[model samples]
Target: MPAIVGIAQVVSVGSSGVFHIGDVFTINPISTAKTFAGAGSFITGRGISVYNESSLTYTVDDEVMDQGINFNL
Candidate 1:
């Protein structure tokens, strides 16, 4: 189906965020965050080391029907 939005307002959209008003087949959002805190707060002194690693995979279908949209005054 479809929808008619008379008025739409979006104040803010942060990282990995989305704001939609019309029809959508799929909306996917992925995010990853890493934080390191030490005695010096992410400050490494002599004879110190840090290591970080991450892996991610995502997939989505490309088959979707046409969704109509209309706006009214």
Candidate 2:
């Protein structure tokens, strides 16, 4: 299980398409790409679909530490 530490406003370079509850995500700050979290990826948080409004933007419940770590989704 993952801890919900805080809320975050994540946005991709462009439209992120539709997001659903429990969707895994990671942030690529360099490219500003908010893509799905995968093996060995640093998991940022899970999706809260109700707040997903635009294709490029969405909200999430953060689970990573301030220092960051690799967590697979």
Off by over 4 Å in 2: 13-73
Clashes of 2: 1
TM-score (all chains, Cα) for each model: 0.39, 0.16
Model 2 lDDT per residue over 1-73, tens place = 5555566566753453443335357643322234654343453567623433444433474957343333421
Give each prediction's root-mean-square deviation over alpha carbons: 14.8, 18.2
lDDT of 1 at 1: 80
Q: Write the per-residue lDDT of candidate 1 for residues 1-73, one digit (tens) a residue.
A: 8988898778899987778888898765555444434343456579876554543333343648433323211
**Highest TM-score scorer:** 1
User: Cα lDDT of all candidates, in order?
Assistant: 0.58, 0.45
